[model samples]
Target: KEPGSGFWLKWLGAPSCQRGSYAFYKSVSSRAQPDGPVQVWRLGEFYFIRCGPQDPVCIAEVTLLWEDQTQRHLLASTRLYFLPEDTPKGRTREHGEDEVLAVSRKMVVRVEDLVRWSCGQPAGWSSSLKLNGLRKPPQSSDSNDKNTTTNTTDKNGPVERQGVKVLSYPQYCRFRSLQRRLQDGARGPGLQDPHLLALGAVRALPNTRVMYCRDTFNHPTLESNTNFSWQFSEYLWSSQQISFRPSACIPFPLFV
Candidate 1:
């Protein structure tokens, strides 16, 4: 792999994994784990993929983790699970926000699209450990220890923990699987440890607004952030989806 080997160029363009032309990885560190205990994605595990700059994230099962040869980029091939809202019937209180409907739709996305679980998710995604059986990070520590701090570093500098920006629709992101119907699709607590909720408190960022409105004609429509300024005039609301995304049952408040 030398300069002008066409890695970055192909990567920037977002090339898909070419058939018979990639290398495999046993696991991949999450591209967007906010704090640190570290989220490592492995095969046969569930995770989320970013769809667009502002669109809601989608949860999928990792089938393969590979590097696209031509682009020299790491990529993930996942089988997506849809929301009941994504179905024709829509959502219900019976279903936990973190639960997802199983489906066979698969897609290839840049590993950068893979994000970790969020704060305050249902118990199914976490076990007694909260890390869901994943291995602990190197030199990781409980934030309770105020006098001691440790971090592994390389030649360039100290390895700082990276955080991802919050999205408006966390409902679409994944955590646990939808179980038997008798349980009302409720998911039990799995295992999770967000770096001690990721070494400290979750970041406090202002949440964007997503409004589902009715025009003078009384037709339902959605008015979201500036980036959402699409031609929504003729758009029709789905009976299955909510007025706006649930977003953790949290209000879309403009104040604190």
Candidate 2:
């Protein structure tokens, strides 16, 4: 039997094959049930067998018998997991859990986190394909308004911000000052001091004065004042911290 010859029918008592060429054979478990010989054959990746009335052979029925056995074997060996038949109508479970992982309210998961988690799986393994179209963050309305209102009627057009533009002396001076300040912090801001919070221009919250004094200075004055120490610790720890790196280019734009 040449490979890719399609079907092998030697077991049908065809003269083309020698006696022992067929790998599968017919057999009965008991003698009480007298039945005709069952035809058996192995073709490519599958094994097939068929048995029925011996006279006026029905080839269609024999083919169907082989198909039924193949289907039965396939279904028995395969494992399929489906949502529980009794799950409540509105309920859902999260993926990969016996019960779906569901949220009653709207939820957002970060793209970076999701990519890191599913880097190697097939497309179907994803939670939903609808969310795959990359969406950009909405541009700030204020910024859009500023661009739209820029005067474009005059030949000079008030020296439009885009394309070649002229800068006033004060604007040039301010730019120079900002350039100098950025140069001074080339390694980026450290995590300590009034300099630390002020360099980043972080907005201060209530009780920040006391908390900043305690944590930034580690003042000895708090030692004699036991009552303030506990409260100071709590306040200091509760503050949200931001860590940023100075970049030659805007990093977030590159990702989008």
Candidate 3:
């Protein structure tokens, strides 16, 4: 007599008693009308389901509706785990004037976008609907290489640059140390910091140009021709003949 009484009957996997049951069953079998979309709702702390028939003897498919209203067909014979008692509850309620209701909630499994059907001869018989969570993209260790030279660029020029000498161990160590201190989580001086200025002085070597050094957001531009200058190459024991001048000097905050 009740609307959802059919659900109980269907869940019980028993033949309906009344004439209406036979009619409903026939409609489901003939037209293959979904009883209803798959739903996720919390009962107390756990979620329960009245998914479509599961018996291999039956001929109905189960479909789940996502938040975006996209429909996904689940594997016919897959077993689904309902929300556990410890799981957080979501807001959803039953349909009106019916013993059964449709609810909305997120799933744990990551369902594919396409719809799947049964593998039967007519390909109609199906079982419970499966729910899945969204998948995350993989992390990349090679992200730093994006700014570095690539194989294609190597063909245009020598793999190494000419007329540029490597920094001595002490000079390199000092520059690297200052860079680490600036990048460390600790709040330190801005570009005006004496340490940064000292590092800049050391980087301004004769015949050795610091091509560019940019921030993650590309806000601060520290290029060889800009934001850098030298009066003499004191580190290399040279003067007058070795004088540097940055096109411009701009100091920007490290944090927004």
Candidate 4:
């Protein structure tokens, strides 16, 4: 929460993801204390933040600290702008509305990490999906083993890997949909809301932050089948299997 703000901030992190604890700092640098005496609370995989009256109006930094004392890293160093009042004059959307990523993105797990987490569970489709891209090809395993040993030395010391794993477009969408449905439960009909889950991951290549299964292309196949029929053409087709046959010979009278 920002200082003098009427509403609290919610962190929308991924479900079932356990990465690390996070804290928000008001100062630009880590050495300075946090603004407004921020308090962090964890419930399951989600974390919530609250600040006292003394907090700063704009937060400058956010830090992610591992449970182990040996590791503490800065997740993001960005300015979080906030509105001074609860009400908006013209636009209802506040400035700091998109800050949900400060937490939820952490739930994205690696293939190896997912395997470790799902160990001992009954083998099925979910297990197979988790191992989709991660399974090493038998032919490449020998060469990969040798290369792994040779590349073990890190010139800059061992660093924790970050960023999302690469997957084909279709595979990524399917994996995201399944992960979200499993985490947030099926919504509406059969897991209709693909984006219902609050989880998200950083995408490769372009390196954009994307919600799992968020098909921005707006393709027909990716859309959910809603029960409600609003279009007149849809009603005619579904109920009568007949479309309006426009007769060029038929004349219509219009009042001027």
Model 4, residue 117: distance off in Å is 32
> For model 1, what is the C-alpha lDDT against the true structure?
0.34
lDDT per residue as tens, model 3, 89-182: 3213421111111112111111121112222222211122211110111123452221111111122432321111123345545645654554
| Local lDDT at 39 for model 1 | 42
Q: For model 4, how does the per-residue alpha-carbon lDDT over 52-151 read when each residue is reduced to its tens digit? A: 2332222112221112112332222111212223112222344222121121111211111111121111222123223222111112234222111121
Write down the TM-score of every candidate.
0.35, 0.14, 0.15, 0.16
lDDT of 1 by residue, 174-220 (tens): 21111121135232244233422332222211121111111112111
Runs in model 2 with CA error above 4 Å?
Answer: 1-141, 145-162, 186-256
Q: After superposition, which runs of candidate 3 have C-alpha atoms over 4 Å from their true positions?
A: 1-165, 186-194, 199-256
Best by TM-score: 1
Across 136-162, the per-residue lDDT of candidate 2 in tens digits comes to 111233521211212122333232211
Collision count of model 1:
22
**Model 4 regions lying over 4 Å from their true place:** 1-52, 56-63, 67-81, 84-256
Candidate 4: Cα lDDT at 249: 18
Error of 3 at 53 (Å): 78
